[model samples]
Target chain A: MKETITLKIKDLFEDIGNQATFVGSFFRNIFRNGFEWNELIRQCYLIGLKSLNIVLITGFVLGFVLTLQSLPTLQQFGAEGYVPNMVSISIFREIGPVITSLICAGKIASGIGAELGSMKVTEQIDAMDVSGANPIQYLVVTRILACTFMVPLLVLFADAVSLLGGYVGTSTAGGMTAALYFSKSFSSLVFSDFFPAFIKSIFFGFTIGFVGCYKGFKANKGTESVGIAANSAVVAASVWIIILDAVAVQLTSIFVYNQ
Target chain B: MENVIEIENLKKSFNGSEVLKGISLTVKKGENLVVLGKSGQGKSVTIQCVVGMIEPDEGSIKVLNKEINELDEQELKDIRGRIGFLFQHAALYDSMTVRENLAFPLKRVLKVKDEAEIEQRSVEALEAVGLADAIDKMPSDLSGGQRKRMGLARTLIVKPEIILYDEPTTGLDTITSKEISRLILSIREKYKASSIIITHDMSCARITADRIVIMNDGKCIAEGTYEQLENSSDTFINSFFKI
Candidate 1:
């Protein structure tokens, strides 16, 4: 039993090391001459534009529900006026970044993982390598950059929609106006609230792309491994998203909150 | 260059198991050398080394008078650009139209900026393989034989100096296999390209090979014309030729 535990621990570390090396390759190939612009634009369209409606709907519903849930609880203590402050702080600091990132981990990570996993199994990657084309540059770097840039943009879009939802939820009690709701929301938000979330979203974006690409590219050699790669990518990316969020919150707490 | 490729005492092992053991072979300019071996032997590994896909742990491979391992990254890419590798599966990018697939190497390796030139060469390449009608179709739409032909056309689009064919006719019906073999023969003559054809397909060897080398147990066990090899007295070699 002890030996088996040691082997499993060793395997996990080796897997992490392999993924780090894969990321290192992504950076190394970025400096090579042939940048794949068309592929990058296509990935941006697929990852960012296509995901817009879904992220918007999810974000709005999340914010609306959080406000409704918090209203009755805070009303019991005569803190109804603090609802906007509560919504703004919660959405910007934690809910917006974490929920949007998890959504992306489910959607884009699985797509990239399955696509590259199938390519690897069919020998298309080897064909590219032997034909003197840079598969790492054409496929991995383009997709990673697309996700890294676009996911942050998606999170910002989601935040706007969510804040609107919060205002709508606030008006349901028949007392506040849109101008008042937004003003109160903005009044409570400082730079620290947005900045930490923005930083976390960037880290989440990198995690999603890196984990997806690594799982897909280094998948075991078989047709079934394609399915395994896509499933594992979603699971791994989701977990990493939360893990990084926790680390970001801790860092934000230690540095800013303490000061 | 008298010898387009020269592999000297090449060896390779994977996970402590040796696949190729001190194998050496040569292919002269414009000569087609077919390597005949059983399924699990290292015939494919040897040709893969010639292209620098598999690093030979113990020896050296020279293509066009330059050592493969000695070349830097750009040099390796340049050398690979000058040499074509036809994988067994044809490996046409399924996402791409046949036309786009053919044009890929030209755009990336040759860096041909003129679209007209790219299209013309692509059309010409398809025409050479009689796959012009497949120009707009996806690779998934192609028959196995058609895919192989398209693969050959993609390789020929670059007009490589040497080509490495890894089991070009493995899964085809016998007639289609022979047709592919003859196409390989004609393409060789037309391009004036040296080639290393790796196969278990005897009919393919008979049609495409200018000379034949037989590999077994990770070594070249016999070498001669196809007819000379067929008449050999060695029992292990004869087992392959026996009808």
Candidate 2:
């Protein structure tokens, strides 16, 4: 048992070494092959445009629920009119980026993982290498670049939709006027609230694409490895997003508070 | 005959479980060399090392007169243009139509910008492999044999100087195996490419090999013409051929 544990550790180290080497090679190929603009556009369409409805629906629902749930507490304070401001701040700074990223982690991360995992399992990756194609540039770069660009667009869309949902929820449940609620919401949101969340999302996008591509590209063993790679891709990306978000929030609070 | 590929003292290990250990071999240009080995005897690793896919810990691999181990990424990419590999399983991209699969490397690697030229070459390759009608079909729509043929079409589309076959007959019916063997020979004749075929299928080795190399325990145990191997008195060789 002890020997088995030691062997496992050794294996893990070797895998880490291989992954480091591959990442270096992956970046090298990305630069060597330059960029494929059409492929980037296609991936943006797939990752961003195709995923808009889910992000919109989920964000709207989340905003509506948060407003509805906050009504009772704000009513107790006799500051129910402040509900929009609170919901807006929460959504813009924390809920919006975090929730949207979790959704994307599930959607885009799994898609990238499964696509590349299947490619690996099928040996299309090997075929690419043999055909003098840099599979990393052709596969991983398109994906990572797509996620980097698309996630920001998706988050921007989601934030807008969610704020609109907040407006509807406050007017209906809290008996606040739509114009007054939106005015309050906008007044409460400064550049500080918006920029930090937006910046964190780029990290979220990078994390999702990086972990997903890493899992899938390094997949080996057989068909079952594809499933494992996809699952771990989602899990790891989601967890990293949350961890990074916390750190970003802390850093933002420090800088903003002093200013 | 000038050597197209040369390996000297190759060694590789995954987690200390060595796959290829101090192995050496060479293949001449235009020669079809069949590497016969059991399933886990490092045959695939040997070929992968030659292509610089799995880097060996020790020793040297020279392909087309260039040291593969020392080449930079761009250099490797340039070297790769001259070699082709037909995977054991067809390995066709599930999302791509057969035509796209054949054209992918042409456009991506070869930087062939003209759509008409890409299409023409794709069709020619498909025609060569008897897969012209399957061009628009997805890989998932093809039969196993058809998938393998499409894989061959994709490999041939590049017009490589060297072709590597990994278990070309492993999953095919005998009839399909014969067809694949014929395809291999036809590819050789058409391109005059140096070929390295790895398989345990004795019939495949017999039909495709100009010279047969037998690997055991990560080492080249014996090598000769197919008839020479078949007639050898060595116990392992005798048992291998079952004659």
Candidate 3:
């Protein structure tokens, strides 16, 4: 048991090192000549347009539920008018970034993992390498950058959808106008709330890209391992998203809220 | 004959098991050298090292008179740019149409900007392998022999002086295998290119080999013309010829 535990720890450290090297290579190759513009556009389209429906539905439902759950409890103190403010602050500040990231963690990360994993298993990567093409430039750099840019855009879109859902939920629960609800929502949010959330979402995007690419790039030589890589990418990306959210919140509290 | 590829004491080990134990061989210019070996005999590893795909633990690989291990990254890329490797599975990029796949390395590595030239070259490559009709078809849409032929077309696009065939006919039927073997011979004749064809397919060897090297226990055990090996006094070498 002791030896097994030691081996597991060793493997963990090795995997982390491999991922750090992979990220370093990604950055190095990003500036390399012959960027795959067509591939990048295709990826952005896939990541953004394909993920739109899920992000929209989830964000809307979560916002509605949050409003419903917070309404009656706050009605005890007759703070019903502040419901929009509270819900908006929560949505823009923390909930929007975290929930959208987790959703992407489930969808985009797994897609990248499975796609690249199958490529690796099928010797497509090897073919690229031997063909003297820059596989890293064509594959990893385009993917990581696509996620880093697209996920944040998805979050911003999701936040808007969720705000709309919040207005609908609040008006149905008691009574509120769209103009007044939206006004209160913005009134409660300052630059501090918005900027930090945006920063966190960007980090969440980075995490998803990093974990997904790492799992897929280093996939073992089997079809079964491709499935494992995809599953592990989602699991790993979700865990990292949560961890990054916590760190972002703590840092935001220290730097923004305190000041 | 001028040597195109020279491997000296090439060795590689995986998880402490030596796969290529001091393999030394050479392929001459415009000569088709086939390395015949059973599975796990390090035949693939040997060719893979020539292209600098797998690094040898201890030894040197010189291709076109340049030492692979000594070349820097860009130099390595420049060297590899001139060599075409067809994977055992053909390994066509599935996301690409056959034309796009052929044009990929041309545009990316060779930096071909003229669309007309790229299209012309891609179509010509397909024509060489008799796969021109399959240009717009995806790799998954093709049959096994067609895929292998398409793979040959993709590799031939770059006009490589040296071609590496890694089990080019491993999974195909005998008829298809013979066609691919004939293609390999025609490719060499038309291009005047040296090639290292790695395979255990005896018919492929009989069809394409100018010289044959039989590998066992990670080293070249015997080498001769096909007929020479076919009538060898050595029982072990003769066993491989026994249907």
Candidate 4:
């Protein structure tokens, strides 16, 4: 048992090292000549456009539930009018970006993992390599960049959707007008709240892309490895997303909120 | 004839088991040299080492006069650019259509930016393999023979000086296999590219081999012309012919 535990820890550290090297290769390939612009555009469309529906639905439901849950508590303090301010701040500062990122971690990461894994198993990657084409430049760098660019945009869109949901939640009881709700939502949300969340969502996106690509790129030669790669990509990306969120929150509290 | 590939005492191992044990071989310019062996005998490993895909544990591999193991990444890419490898399963990029697949190596490796030239070359390559009508279809839509032909087309598009085929007719019907074997001979005549074909198919060897190397237990056990090996009095080599 002790030896097994030690070997597991060694494997964990080795995997982290391998991932660091992969990310380094990604940066190097980004600056290489003949960057694959067309592939990047296609990946962006696939990752961003295909994920929009889920982001919208989830964001709206989250805001609606938060508003409904917080209403009675705020009513006890006769602070019902502050519901918009609370919901808006919560959605923008934490909930919107985190939830959307987790959803993308589930959807986009697994899709990339499975696709690349199958390609690896089928010898397509080997074919590309032997043909003198840069697989890292064409495959890994494009998908990661697309995810990094698209996730923030998705979060911003989700933020707006959630605000609309919050308004609907407010109307379920005796409520303010749309104009008043919009005004209240923006009144308390300063630049600091929005900027930090946007920045962290970008990191979350990178994590999702990096973990997925790394897993898929290093997939072993088998049909079983494809499923393993996809499942592990989601699990690893989600864990990284949560860890990054915690770190971002702590850093934001120290630097932005304190001042 | 000038040798396009020269391997001396090549050796390779995986997980403590040696796959290629000091295997030595060569392919002459414009000759179809077939490496015949059963599975796991490192026939594929030999050509893979020649292409710099798998590094041999020992021995020197010289492809077109450059040492494969000694080349840097850029130099290796340069060497690889002049070599076409057709994997066993055809290894088509499933994401792209047949035309796109042929155009890919041309665009990326050859840097052919002219769209018209790309289209012409892609169409010509497909036509050569009798797959021109399959241009717009995806790889998954192709039949087994069509996929292999499409794979050959993609390899031919770059106009490499050397082609390596790994089990090109493993999973095809006998008629399709014969067709592919004939295509291999025609490709050599038309393109003037030397080839190292890895296979266990006796019919494929009889049809295409200008010279044949038989490998067993990770070593080259016999080398001769098809008729010479076929008429050999040695029991082991005669056993291969009997099959």
Give all candidates' CA lDDT scores: 0.90, 0.87, 0.91, 0.94
- Candidate 3 per-residue lDDT, tens place, A1-259, comes to 9999999999999988988889889999988888889889988899888999999999999889889999999899999899889888899998999999999999999999999999999999988988888888998888888899999999999898888889889989866888999999989989988899998898899888888888898897999989998999999999999988888889998998883
- Report the C-alpha lDDT of model 1 over A50-161, residue by residue, as the tens digit: 9888899999998788888999998999998888999999999999989999999999999999989999998888888999999999989988998898889889888888
Instruction: Chain A only: give the TM-score of model 3.
Output: 0.97
lDDT pick, better of 2 and 3: 3
Residues A1-259, model 2: lDDT tens digits: 9999999999999988986886676677676645777777898899999999999999999888888899889899998888888988999988989999999999999988888888888888887877777777878887887888889778988888888888778778747777888889999999988998899999898788888899998788588989989999999899999899889988997897563
DockQ for model 3?
Answer: 0.84
* Tens-digit lDDT track of model 4 for A47-137: 9999999999999998889999999999999999999999999999999999999999999999999999999999999999999988999
TM-scores of the candidates, chain A only: 0.96, 0.93, 0.97, 0.98
**Model-by-model DockQ, in order:** 0.79, 0.70, 0.84, 0.89
DockQ of model 1, rounded to 2 decimals: 0.79
lDDT of 3: 0.91
The worst-scoring run of ten residues by lDDT in candidate 4 chain B lies at B234-243
Candidate 1 segments whose C-alpha is farther than 4 A from its true place: A1-10, A172-175
Which lDDT tens digits does candidate 3 get at residues B165-227?
999899899999999999999999898889999998999999999999999999999999999
Candidate 4 lands at a TM-score of 0.98
Candidate 1: CAPRI quality band: medium
Q: How high is the DockQ of candidate 2?
A: 0.70
lDDT of 2: 0.87
Every candidate's fraction of true contacts kept comes to 0.71, 0.81, 0.76, 0.81
Model 4 chain A: lowest-lDDT 10 consecutive positions? A167-176
Score every model by TM-score.
0.96, 0.93, 0.98, 0.98
